[model samples]
Target: MMKNIILITLLAGFGFNLNAQPLAPDFTVTDSDGVEHQLYQDYLNQGKTVVIDLFFTYCPPCIALAPTLEDFYESWGGGTGDVEFIGLSIMNDDFNSDCAQFKIDHDVSYPMVGIDGGAIPAVQPYYSGDWGPFEGVPTFVVIHPDGTVDFDPSNGVYDGPGVTGLLEEAIRETGARKPYHLTGTVTMPGGNAIGSFDLNIEGELYSPGQMLPGGLFELDILLRPDSTYEISAVKSGSYNEGLTTFDMIKIRKHVLGIDNFQEPWKYLAADANSSGGISTADLIQLTKLVLAVSDNLPNNDPWGFIKTDYLFASPANPYEEAYQGDARTYMF
Candidate 1:
């Protein structure tokens, strides 16, 4: 009996793990549109080749590659000769809305579904490797028609040529094609060392996993220029505190008193409002200051130059204090 079993095993592929199934794991998830999708029944097991990517929108590299992913999906997704693409977002709490908005903003045409903790391990093969390690976001996995993984695009450096070449080969083999490009860098506010904070972009919050040797948080953003955007950072679940700190970054287009000053100040001269050569508006502003009725005054016109209470001592005289407590300085 032992000899017969050994012969059978040798005939079948001796080194193969007999208990290892060649089939991919099964799962079910709901898309952004509230539709339930079964992985094996509706996609893989039905003779379709699928590409699954695990990511969250707040991840900078993930956001940066979004356009490329969208372009690829549009070219070859959903019944395009047995090829399908899906994005799995792994965000918690408030990040859900942000991820949803990111999909819309980036014009991601494919379905982006949210997976709970129970479903995380079922998809681990796509992210984990035989070396007992896992690659984070922007990971890609190609599932073959026979239900086994044909190519794992994770663990490799994300570059345009390499990614495109591998994807092209996969396309030729599986008849699945999607136009994709790998670009962008992961960056955080305050020079990439955000202490222990997470950034929130378009409502999605991202925590910088573990502090590296440099004490920088894991918050990185991938972005393209000439695009309208807003980004903020928080201390994870402390939304209220995070919101306050995030809002403190005031963005203004004009300078107050100095041309190159970096610190905040409380005053500007009457002539400072003139951007396109002083006109009637400037005179009107001066008149309001003189009459102590200027609506734009920070805390009542202190100079009283408007009231002629103070006069210029010289043609090049520096601006005098407008009020008793006003210590405003000029920035030139």
Candidate 2:
């Protein structure tokens, strides 16, 4: 065990305890990218081993060790592997942008959180002796999937390559499993790519929906293996994009049976109240939305997702005979 140690170089005049906390305390912090990560829910509960590197923006040893940490992060599949790495700012006033810039300067690819991103409070328990003894900057902590903390996991080896090796060995000792990935492109019926949209992911672990930017959806989010997820894509705002008086006429006709919708999705789209059926009420709601009397439809989103593979029981009239269907469920 002594040979496997990576002694960390402190910021000078500071010391660390040889003993680590038996159980890791939990925390939630947002990263520079505005992504929220929770310790127990997002990683450990999902069976991942997490390595936390705590440092201030200008710490000398932290700066020098950045690149090696980046290499270590990539070795674990850049957050897609069983191991996840995060850099946290120990300073109380470092902004999210500061952490972002620090990562750019240090060429670190892993997630970095700063004071504005909730790093201060997140790290307080560790260094304040609430969790255990922690005495300095540029400290490395490895938390196993079992929620056990391994402080000074690198055995105080401050050198880059050696520290990386020790951290890897420590992670391997935890027996973490590779993460599952939730990834795919979101597009409209006409194959129009959506640049940004909200994602509601629910499964063994529930993450509040976040509007994932263009790159992340396809790049994939790590998920718990063998767990099921119900995903929904929602795009809102621009409440009256294609609505007009002429469309209102079409709805009126469909309601009166003078002319009916040809496609099942048309009924889903035309049902402005989400009442499961088309009627004069839908036409009135459409009229209000189109005329700018109201900015939204009653009980309905500006847009709703139907599974790409969903097949309506009644193709011509989706609402025929109290239809109960899978149109509202999505999986990736």
Candidate 3:
């Protein structure tokens, strides 16, 4: 019983260690003007509070919240150092120029970005709930000035009193006092015209109809820099079913350190080969791998590939005695 308990505890610890979300990744996306924009370096880093809402132009709840979100933006978006509101329009087969026109007809004043292709994963996390099973429209997420997720609503419509109150609370917490420099462009895989599409970023929708051309087919967004973002595109038409492309994006303020750290190996390295942290026990395990005397090397090791491409030069020499001893000494 004690041995089983220890095994279970060790497994639980490993699982938790494996599930950490890496430091946010950054990305660059284009806007309606075909200009490139960086998420984190341009907007979030500029000291402006950001409110990102996701929606489809044709979605009833999204449309209903449009005017309300606009009203909030008018009230809070202007003036120096105030909250910045952005809408990301999830563009799919049903999203087109007509949908954009509908947004214009409704008088939405904020900028909207459109996603092209099937990049749903890019923006799924922003909507809250079980990301893999998101089932709500007009999901909202607020990013604090410091670039951490402040509010993420799972299931519900915006424009409700509760949502408004949450928005207000987010604004109070951000307390940003600087205007954001916004810019970005929309593009297709081959630079082909994205005939009538919507781009959803985070939880906001950017409809082309509200802009100059009846349906601004492509989009690019700019905001405070170093902000995390998700972008996706949807296109719809008669003969073809709707298609979407999703991608998670982060706009970085500076270059990041690149290291080839793979799992299992990294986990083992972290544990110094012992069941836990680096210690004398880990040294014993390292010796086993080195002498090919242990069954620790699984045939289909996920971490093995990662280690080969990153830390070590070859699979045959995955763990050198010197390297193992060094890692165990330092990591512990």
Highest-scoring model, lDDT: 2
Instruction: Indicate whether candidate 1 or candidate 2 has the larger TM-score.
Output: 2
lDDT of 2 by residue, 245-270 (tens): 87777777888899987866677778
Q: By TM-score, who's the top model here?
A: 2
Candidate 1 lowest-lDDT run of ten: 1-10
lDDT over C-alpha atoms for residue 124 of model 3: 52
Estimate every model's Cα lDDT from 0 to 1. Answer: 0.45, 0.68, 0.42
TM-score of 2: 0.47
Q: Where does model 1 exceed 4 Å of error?
A: 1-22, 77-81, 93-96, 116-122, 125-132, 175-332
Where model 3 places Cα greater than 4 Å from the true spot, the runs are 1-25, 33-36, 94-99, 117-122, 127-133, 151-157, 177-332
lDDT of model 3 at position 199 = 44
Model 3, range 227-298, lDDT digits (tens) per residue? 444433333332111111110000010012133223224333323333333333443443444444653522
Point out the higher-scoring one by TM-score: 1 or 3: 1
Error of 1 at 198 (Å): 59
